[model samples]
Target chain A: MTDTRMATDAAATWHARLDSPDMDWEDFGRWLDADPSHRAAYDAIAVLDAEIGERAAAIAALLPANDDEVAVPASDAGVPDAGSASRGTRWRWAAIGTSGALAAGLALLLVAPSNDGAAQVYATGRSETRSVTLDDGSRMQIDRGSRVSVTGGGTPVIEIAQGAASFAVRHDPSRVLMVRAGGYEVRDVGTRFDVVSARGRVAITVAQGMVSVVPSGGAIGDATMLNAGQSLTITPDKQIAIRGRIDPARVADWTDGRLDYDGAPLTLVAADISRYADSPLVVDPSAADLRFSGVLTIGDGSRLVDQLRAVLPIRARRVAGVVHLDAAGPR
Target chain B: MLAANRHQLVRFFTGRTGSVAEAEDVVQEIWLHVGQPPKADGVTGEPGAGPIANPLAYLHRVGMNIVLDRVRANGRRQRRDAGYVDATTSTVGAEAIDDAPSAFDAVADKERMARLTTALTGPPEGAMRVFRRHRIDGASHAEIAAEFGISRSAVEKHIAVALRHLRKALDD
Candidate 1:
């Protein structure tokens, strides 16, 4: 066979193996690296494969139906219509909703607090991170799938309803900033910190300065002071609060699309990944105590579980659109 | 594993793309696809489920696919630019000069669609059906094979044949 023909066949074989779990990626890489023409051949095949998918609906409309095969009922859920114009319209609406939410987020930052002291709620969509600068110049970077309500004008009371956020409060002894999550309050005169409130648990990581953590109605004298590089976590059932050391630089790294964990619980990692995940991610009880210490790049939020699987001895299985992370069995 | 071998992946991509910056961009894209959802429905096996025999080689393969995607995009952009220049020079006094690019794109898309339609008809018997079932209908290879009363490899061959024909048609 001609070199071009041989490369084309090899490229086709590699493309076919793309969906295989046991795919030999290293061998495939070597094949591509062996000759530059091999790369060109593989590129054409791969791009064509993707184009076929992109134009699937259009192509389906053009082609004759598979009359001999059993036709899948249209009412079946999760199965997209092979030739539906509605799919296009749904995508258009999705695009509009994304931009609309972004515009609303910007407007929320500019709007002045109401005189009535009514709390204004701010929320971020799945896979979206938002930064808000309050009137007092204290900035809060809200993580994906999070909600925070702001009340009070000069001395704002920020409440995290769900998910995580990082704060850089302007140091002002005269005006104290209060952050509430899961019935616990963080009082700051001036500091940078991260608060994650989910699953009835609250974790506060202090990157810079000092912050006092106390119950909502607790007195200041009884509050626990968390200094820079210290993290505090309050368990849901026991209400037992534990303090630990953390890298000051890694606090709120999610704002930069990186999840830097230092021996964090698997449950906590799953909770963070759930923010960007399309389906609910449940951690198996057996894997509850597993701790993860690594840096994961959150690009579009799809591969977080994959990255976790690579480092941790965990396997993810999707059932009814929900992903479950379980400890791997002995091979 | 990806975190530990990130530097090596960058080096591999840099060697191929010839620029550290571009290599980093490709590596970033690889991270996105590393834990991607399984392509076939009801397929429980994860890509990196077990210990990879050669992790660096696996990463390099992922990087290669991303580089190919970038190359393909560049090729498409160049083709579009050449078409735009051709249309502008050939039709100096044409109406709606401002809409030339969009018009040209529409024409190109229409031509490609027609070619694909013609190519679909030219594939060998049953190849088109298998391709449509898997690609257009999103059926797994196992599902398509069962429907056709054929082996999984046969289903794959049909797909490869259909793809080869389609690629040739588009090239023309």
Candidate 2:
């Protein structure tokens, strides 16, 4: 073989080896020190790998055991095989495992500031506003009755399990910011986006810059890069596709004292308000299809009840932070 | 109209009878009755009937009964109305709904807009833009709100002043 061909073969071999969970650290370090471009390439590959694992965990949330077949299609060469763990257990894979753990750890990332040193949880009762400062200097607001677990694992990772949660991510490309729930996984290299999980689907709306949601895993095969005004939805089965533009203001309105809905389902509004309310907004048989527009002020119960009574003709009253809505007067 | 307005009826019925699907079923019944409206029963009255009071209110009450009867036939007061208003609208509007929609879009709510306008009195006109950029647009107000923890009054004040100024500017 020609000298150039010999060198090319060797480089490809090395590149493949580094991606394996068991690649030699000494050899990898020597390579990284050998060339700056080599280090950059490695960093890119590592970030990409971490993202893939994260996507899997996100997809895992929505997929039933039956869906495991079609979700990680047998034809997909890019997706990790469901049987990957059987190959070998390597500590180097710890980084990958940590990324996976972060993805898994993410479901528990909600609650006060203590789940993880870097995690910040913002919770609100019905009609109450909750704000939090993340370790990365970003801020998050958890709308009434909702709990979000935040962690700064591979990047500043966070997961919203239920209700409504808003993220104001600090710009840090070096640290990826992610939010996971149901079938939705939002990864921002460093952008602002709001992720809401309700019903069985997760909706990701980009407010600024760009963000990417690939069917819970990072691959060009299933990824859709979203820009400002763009949005994506992850179906109940881990399927994701570029949806359309959503109102950026409404996406992050919980913190701003406005719960903006353009004919949203009462179930969704209930989910959003459930976070702030001490008592959940029960979308009853009478209230489920009700679509409310304009801002539903959330701060205290009596006021919320009064507001519901005044604006929409629904009766609502707060017990603790839980504001119950009913057709009957201020129950 | 049943499909198109099924959702609107859900919202309207949601306001009145507090049943989204009952409102929806009423819409279904209304569609059956008025779908071909011989221009008699559907008109409610004549054109000169003049801005009828509580037309929607009366319809909402009618729809509620229909839904209740349907539910009562099966016999249940569901803790959760999982079947009301099919998610067709939610799924369709999911991507299109604006959270921080452009201020320039035609907002249909005049009273709320007036309230937003009235709230702008305390801050300078630029304050609303800042409010839009930081709060509405989701910018961290650390630099704009001028503190790590922004106080409620400061935010209200910024908006109030901006609205007041806008109201004045528009008046001229």
- Give the number of the best model, judged by TM-score: 1
DockQ of each: 0.11, 0.01
B39: Cα error in model 2, Å: 48
Residue A18 lDDT in model 1?
Answer: 44
Candidate 1 chain B weakest lDDT stretch, 10 residues: B90-99
Each candidate: what lDDT? Answer: 0.66, 0.45
TM-score of each: 0.41, 0.36
C-alpha-based local distance difference test score of model 1: 0.66
Residues A1-331 of candidate 1 have per-residue lDDT tens digits of: 5787667766766665443333444455456567788767777877777666656668778876644554322122121211111122211122332432322221112112221133556898877889998755699999888899776544577889898889998743333467889889887756899999976679899898767677877743346667778888897579799888889998888989899998999987897787677788999887887999999988778999999999999999999988999889853
Model 2 Cα interface RMS deviation (Å): 30.2
In model 1 chain A, the worst 10-residue window by lDDT is A82-91
Q: Write the per-residue lDDT of candidate 1 for residues B8-111, one digit (tens) a residue.
A: 77766665565689988887655443432222422222232223334444455556655754665576557656764233322212222222245655787788
- Worst window of 10 by summed lDDT in candidate 2 chain A: A106-115
lDDT of 2 at B112: 36
